[model samples]
Target: MKKIIAFLILTQSIISCSNSDDSADDNQISGGKYYAVGSTYGKNKDNNFTQLASVWIDGVPTILSNTASSSVANAVTFYNNDTYIVGTESLNNGNAILKIWKNNTGESLTDGNHTVEATDLTVNEGNVYISGNEFIGTLNSSIATIWKNGQAIRLSDKTSEANAIYVYNNDVYATGYKIIDDKKTAIVWKNGVETVLTSEQDDLESIATDIYVDANAIYVTGYLRNSFKSKAILWKNNSPATLSDENDFSQANALFVHNTDVYVVGCHIDTHQYDFVGKIWKNGTLVKEINGANPKSIIIKNNKIYTAGSGLDEKGMNDEGKIWESNLNNLDFIAKYKFPNNKVNAVLVK
Candidate 1:
């Protein structure tokens, strides 16, 4: 059976920061401090392409050590003033290796023996948890896997993949999907127990991209495919809430809950023009939209909302990493940072 791959668009757009300077060693990029992790690509002297894992501290770019092959930094977090990034690095034998960077030092999670990718990461009480998928056997079927402190735990029986992970109250929650009878089913695993979030009777394909837990409530965001279109969906304690209609293709990539209000950020695809429009929904209401960009992750700091991802450049030809900030007092974007030729998969505020 052919695999049904789910693509995630990571883009965002807002005003450029005025404090950007030409200094290469500056610790801050846009007058404020923020950390972002992603990949940077360039052409070698022989005109061949090369990629490197990169992390930015307050806008200062730092290329990670492993340059043997292409690498990507997928998620970033700060725990006890130490930075951590999770992603994958390619080996010479054509296998992808899961790797984590702590304070700019790279630690390989796999010995390049199997294919693995770390999509999201979280740290709780000094314990690190990373979520993604690992291929099994010659069939290469994906198995949703979570790694805690370098220990691997499989979460799925058949073909599955994990996108986001959260650890709350000493319980680990992983959000992703599994192939049941050849159809993808949205699921959440709490302490290794599986809970199906979508029903087959809906007659639509679904996926849960990100998960969050607050107190006693659990929230998961993604999209449901209905015929030719997809609609963004949010599940609050297993209750489904539609964030978008069936008119267009949309998915929620990340979400945050603050003071009983839920905020989700993702992308809506315009079929006619093939454009990806960044969107943010607040409590099931459309809050913001931007063309040619996709919001990947969101966070609330100091009562302000910030989203980090990638967006089309001014010429609309190439994509660049960007960060956008907003608040309830000002619904409009307040500040932004753009780094050319890079894509930010995650963001951390200090």
Candidate 2:
């Protein structure tokens, strides 16, 4: 199958302090140095629809990838005044080269002979850890992989992908899915040992997209899918707990834990996948349901709740990246900013 990329102009609106109080308040939304990682669509040199990996700082975007191929930023992290971004740059052959950017400079981890992607990353003691998958061309199968300082570590022998990574006490933890008997079973790996988070069911599929580990327990969030319904799930110490209601199907995209309180963000869709509404859950209870959107990342900084993701376009078929700010206590609206024609994947506040 051939991939068709979308082309759209991405524009940024710089908000700054002005004479009006409303303008100053709006500028305070992203007051400090803020970062959002994603991709923006534009026409490349060939006049073809393509994208460039970018990091948005205070609503202004700085492109990170070369124009040789289309690229995207899937995750972002900062450590000791250095910024790290992980994603992929596509080749004409449809293969992707896993790309990493440090402080707006980019490099390739792979040669682009086969497909490779990085969804999340972390920096511990100046060592870069990235979670992703690399396709084995001859076998046509993908393996869940972790890269430590540019060295690849495989977590599975079969089809699998790791979407999130966390390092605690120098122990590496990752979560995603492994294919079992043609079904997807959510899994976690601690120091390369596989731990199953869901039972393999022939008629059902499951995935663990995010993982967090502490002294208390291992926390993960994703979804279990059957034919007609999907449920947002949180796994604590390998035990499954659904976070969705009976009336709607849902998928948890990412989660954050603060002061022993688990905070999750995702989207709820109807059975037919028509209507969509963003939602937040606190400690297994529904805290708020946002506008129609899909939140990809959520975090709490300085007692403020910040979410970065995409909302449906006018046609409700495409995604337009946005950042939402709200009060952490009551989930009340504080501010919002939209990036035209961009798809945000991660956010970082400094």
Candidate 3:
């Protein structure tokens, strides 16, 4: 099941600002720096679609890989003025290889021994930490794995996957889920110690997509299945706080903590229309919504909220990467960047 979802989930979507006072120039704050990594699709001379791994810094895009094979840049971070990107590349043998790129130089993390992927990465004190999973055994069950400076650390015995990673005070934290009795169970690992975040008695599926740790709290955001629908949730120090109504299926993809407030970004599926609507919650309250978008990552800096994700195209057949900036006071979109024919997976603001 984890493998199925891993192959299905592509990337995150868009918010349009309506206020006349909100202009595109309002999003362009002086001296503000931002970085985003993702995959862009382009047509080749043969009229074939090709995937190009790319990174964008301050609205400028740099292609990292544009070969015949498909590639993606899933996550990006900066350390000591160097940019690092993590994602997957397709090999000629039809195997997916996990890769890390620093300053446009590529490093293979997997030798195509098995299907693997790098979901998120963080750099702390010159040490690079990555969260992902590798298939093992004949069943091809995913194992939750973290790499510290290229060293592998397995955090789960059963089928699992790590979607996000964070390093705080030299402690490694990963958020994902493990399979227990064929049920998805949300979990957070701190220094290789696992703590389940969802209730076992519910027998419903749950997953933790992202994790954030501040001086005062540890926050994880995802969703828990309830009967016929899923509910978005934010867990702080193992305590669950529901962020969406149980009547609709919703999932929180990422979260950030600023001062005393918690911000979460994700999407909710409308049962009637089957449309996915992007949403953001502040301190467990729904504060914004974007039609035809699904938010994946968020950051709050200098009293501004920046979110990166994807938005459905006019035909609703493809998704395009988008970044939205909003003022913290009114929460209205001030500026937005759209990458047509691409999907954004992660974002960083510094």
Candidate 4:
């Protein structure tokens, strides 16, 4: 069934004007360090492999052109102070490619030859990290692995999948799930060390979608489910916390930590199956719904909150993409735009 989603304008303006006068064009178009997927010059959904791609501030999108012809970009993370951006790419054949772009030049970091599917991207210091699966010889049996600078480190080879990655103090953390003895179990890896965080329950499917690192701890958020519905969850030092009201199916996809406040973005499905209402959780409290849309990424700069994700139209069909920027101090929404859909995934303030 098609789903109907809404992108609402928070009538209240919480964004404030700052003393620093950065022109919109200068701030967004010139020497910008954010990451996104814009529509390739000529591609669409009918191509069976067409999707969003990464672009630079200079008005050019990062693409391999040859191997990733019909690839859809999932998410992007800027590393090394935005000097480098890393994300996942897929080919029309369904094989995934982990690609790295330097600046906005479209330079690649994949040795120019290899098949991969990157689910998440992150970096610490000068190191780039990716978590996803490595394809197995023409089969569906891909192995869960995390790559550091293109070097593959398998976390779980047990017919598993890795969806997210984070680096804290140079220690790598990857989360996903594995099939053990015909049961699904949630898993997390620290520096390639495997640790099972949740058991294999029949009705439970635990998947960690994002990771947040602070000076002292790591916070992970995703969804855990039984046979019927799922619930939003957070893991501190690998411990779980339920964030949904009873009977509400929810998920937290992207995470950001600004000082002592922790923010997460995703969607929640009410008991009536309201079709995954877009949601944000700030420091353990349900703040506001940007729209009936799902949030893919979030950022806080200069005390302003910005969110990027997508929503569905009234016809219950996924609509155009979006970006929401909060007023000063993030007291309310300042501006909302139908973000370009060429293949953008994530946004960064600096």
RMSD of each: 6.5, 7.8, 6.1, 7.8
3 or 4, greater by TM-score: 3
Per-residue lDDT of candidate 2, residues 59-143 (tens digit): 8888787465688888877666677788888887889999889988888898877898787887776678888888895787879
Model 1: per-residue Cα lDDT over 2-98, one tens digit each:
1322332221111111100111121112324677778777543344577678888777888784565678788876666677788888877888888
> Which runs of model 3 end up more than 4 angstroms from their true locations?
1-31, 43-48, 314-318
Q: Which digits, one per residue and each the tens of the lDDT, describe model 3 over residues 218-312?
A: 88887777446677889988888999986767888888777678888888876565567889998999999988877777877778888888777
Where does the lowest 10-residue lDDT sum fall in candidate 3?
13-22
- RMSD of model 1 against the true structure: 6.5
Which stretches of model 4 miss by more than 4 angstroms? 1-34, 38-41, 44-49, 56-67, 79-82, 88-94, 107-115, 137-139, 198-203, 270-274, 313-318, 328-331, 340-343
**Each model's lDDT:** 0.74, 0.74, 0.74, 0.58
**TM-score between candidate 2 and the true structure:** 0.87
Pairwise lDDT winner, candidates 1 and 3: 3
**Candidate 1 accuracy as lDDT:** 0.74
* TM-score of every prediction relative to native: 0.88, 0.87, 0.87, 0.77
